[model samples]
Target: MTCSYASRARFHRSMTRPFFSKDRISHFDIFEKHAEDALNQVKGRLKEGYPVDFQDMVCRFTLDSATEFLFGKCVGSLSAGLVYPKDSLPGQNREYANHPSNLFARALSEAQSRSMLRSSMGTNWRLAEFWSDRIQKDMEVCHRFIDPILKDALERKRSTKEGEQSTGHAYAEGKGFLEDTLLGHLVNCTEGKADEIVNMLIAGRDSTASTLTFLVYMLSQYSRVLKRLRAEVLSTVGNSRRPTYDDVREMKYMRAVINETLRLYTPVPFNVRTSTEAALWPGVNGGPPIYIPPNTQVPYSVFLMHRRKDLWGPDADIFDPDRFIDERLKYLTSNPFIFLPFNAGPRICLGQQFAYNEASFFLVRLLQTFSSITLAEDIQTRSPECDKGAGRDAQEKVIVKHHLTLYVDEGLWVRMGEASNSDDV
Candidate 1:
């Protein structure tokens, strides 16, 4: 979809309104605000010596934001600052809200669930079964969350149906995204389209959250880089007001910083696809043919490719946002596969632009408030233990695992302090 500033603004306003008025998913609208708010919240936590739990915060933020956009009401997570309402109805809470017992609880919960399922499962069709269950669970949550809203919307539609002039078509005027779409696609998509929306939320929230966490951690590790980033943010965005979308777009250094973070700590580390026909991959001599049956799985490890020494050089492991400077990337090869944090090919992430806006806005807000980010003494002592599961031998490794998406075994914890008083970097 071609995302326009006007379109984003419209979606943002639509989400805050009582009725879900559009038939399309407007992720940019929902993510823009929450991303900045989330950064501020995380920065506060860091300054107070609170452990950075990206998984829990990301899951809840993404879920609630996506839910609000899809259903036209806050999920009570983001606005209320609660994962799940403690006094909510039990069965309803499990189905509609993010349950503590569910995989939606934290990053570790999801990682561990996938790990256990992978290890103890039957090799024959375990993956298929797990995927099926996951889909079912996603559908259940979507339906429960949207059903009541949809019903109310439909009722409102019916009340205004007789009086309103239609193109000989019966439709709901003040319906949410689900109802608006149903007004059109109720014929073809006989199954739960609500689940489809949930699937999109599932795909978006955690990955973005994980990426932001990594970005913050990296900023802390490279304090000097964070200083430059803050200078750039302050110069471009200023401190008098929060940044707008346009301000975020103009901050070149902040943009590069986020791009570098995606390269180094990709949230979705790998993607699997089955080749429908015999195909040739790069790097092999003579373009050697690789055989694949219809159902054969092909794994493309993005993490490995992003950290490829041939593409990024000896300093590939270094957290240097300057690598993204035009002078640097200009000398780089034009290979598309060099970086795939959001994937490449036909099935790349659709919410890429929105994610960028949110991440940038949040980072800008964070740096504006904090002077510096450093590793706490206690956190530093546990670095080895934390890094054990973090998937690599980097200075800030934490156990990272590929469940459905990549997530740290623990969380991204850091210490943030006041920024340098000097406005100039």
Candidate 2:
């Protein structure tokens, strides 16, 4: 349902209350289960010495995790199995490539890409699709996958309400009815429950997947950083032991690695917002203030901002997690606005902390399981030259682009060396 900005903000805040609760956030076991499953899938694919599309595997991982968290049942994307580099012997597995969950993921991704294109087109978006609705089919595919789950949730909610009324054990009015999952809570109060759940799936799945993809990509490029990060992971969580919430929190360098990845390859690189009222923005240097009228669409790029030399220092173009931990972190401390991978203010991502936790949990398990990572550049589908830029950008080994979120163009193809017992801390 359509809502005014103020009302929508309130609704979003209320909807996300579950995530803000400490009790809810303490569910690390659920996150770890999905991470372990995804890691095992990666290992399975690499067992034959074939490179796996790590990006695709992580996307499945996040999708399964997000669906389970929001809908109480995972879509089982990981069970579809990991995809191999194109044209390879293993890549010919038509069954794996055409799995139902994989189809749903592709449809969702296509829908997101189309939505982004429409947003970029502004008023002319409709005209481009005047002859036919390009997004309809893909959205139908998505709905087909989600509607049954949503219907089941609604039925469960109805049953619960009837039970409460018959037993005269209705929850107190002020405390609100407690629901076990976000889907239960949403189905209890929202008319557009399906839409809300889908929106959240996009936020939860793609953002974390992108971060993990780039984090791995970055690590593959920098052996020293990978070694140091693995060292920290082993020192803190150890091998074979599942990482707890507190264990993840204690891995400071690992957190820096994640933050650095977010800084360099922000998932939602570009975002737009409409001004609710007239405002004035300070100009650069000593220039006069610039006026902004009400309803003006303001587009911002955290991606570009994150790479600015003046803001992040001369080595801004470089990938160094140390900047986040060393004295150079003072720049970000003094100018907080300079770093905003998750945006800022009232509309900041409600899933920000969840994304951090998910990425960290997965990375910890990954380091524990793998001793080394190398890019399968020989089979990489997208050419690095596709991303045209100077300096460090020009030297990038893989193509990166965005749909609703940043992603490596084809996929982040990599071969991982399994951690031997001797490699363990």
Candidate 3:
């Protein structure tokens, strides 16, 4: 039987305290290494003259960072330097050897997709997952692939407590932020730690990766936005050194770009909630309130809502980072419900700040390292369905797929290179 729904919620609430504060998750060298790995992936792919898979690069980067941040051990997705070969074994088709935890990443993706399918099934969701052989296999793979890593973390934490603290401490000495992570605090966490840790990993990995993937894709298409962001990064971070936690916060335009991207793409386009008791939801424009019966499931689309003309004005659909900075901003702070990228409740993402830090750090490093990112000419665009009065063309439209989060229907393919002028920005 499942237990601790309340306890798990409480645990996340407790976890959020350290995760959200200004300098909280600040000491993160794991993020720095993974960010470098992401840049390196792009660099390698650029030299090959083939379009780099922005999706895979960010996916590996997030997987590595999330694992190390949460479990005290890295999954090594980026470090392996492998471009996963289709229709081949883990390490079979690339220059770099694949990480063994590739199985874990694949399993986690499959599991999330399967769960999304089930969630779309209303009250009878479990029956669908129960009946599907593919889902059952996904479950098995997840258990087999991720359990050992969880066990290792638990063992490491246990050992550290039992006369090994001095050893771990000595090892952490002189390594910047070596122990500044969530892992060290979990030593005394009892019962349900596995589930809690895995839940965090699932939240931590794909959402950030998907956001970064889409951000890069959007930036390539929206060069003006990228230029401004790169300028902000250069002005704040400079080219010679990696950014500190404080440096990321000071980049106003970078934060605006991220907020705008989150507004448009919102990794989890919508979320669902079931009412345990009857309730009333107020309607818009002074309309009558609507009553919701008990056991009713309500789904709200943050993506569609964010683009509404009523809230965002005539050019609501336009990709503009300036809105967050100038007079156009509202709803985010004034009316929270209309703009719930991370949702508006106790269960709101505990790692939201962690995600911002990770993204900001990487973007700064990326701007410092690369001159330009452009859509690869060899790659075809996804066709648009009915502009229905909008002026934008079919090719400029984005096509996305929904699992637990959104992904580009076709992988985001782009070309990148070293910056021509370090002082340009």
- Model number with the top lDDT: 2
Q: Using TM-score as the measure, which candidate wins?
A: 2
lDDT by residue (239-272, candidate 1, tens digit) is 5457776777788888888888888878777666
**lDDT (Cα) of model 2:** 0.84
Model 3: lowest-lDDT 10 consecutive positions: 170-179
lDDT scores of the candidates, listed in order: 0.58, 0.84, 0.72
Q: Write the per-residue lDDT of candidate 3 for residues 126-231, one digit (tens) a residue.
A: 6655755557786787677567765655555555555346564432322222235464444344534446666777878888888888789789988888888887
- Name the runs in model 2 displaced over 4 angstroms: 1-3, 169-178, 191-194, 283-289, 382-390
For candidate 3, the TM-score is 0.85
Location of the lowest summed lDDT over 10 successive residues in candidate 2: 169-178
Q: Give the TM-score of candidate 2.
A: 0.93
Clashing pairs in 3: none
Point out the higher-scoring one by TM-score: 1 or 2.
2
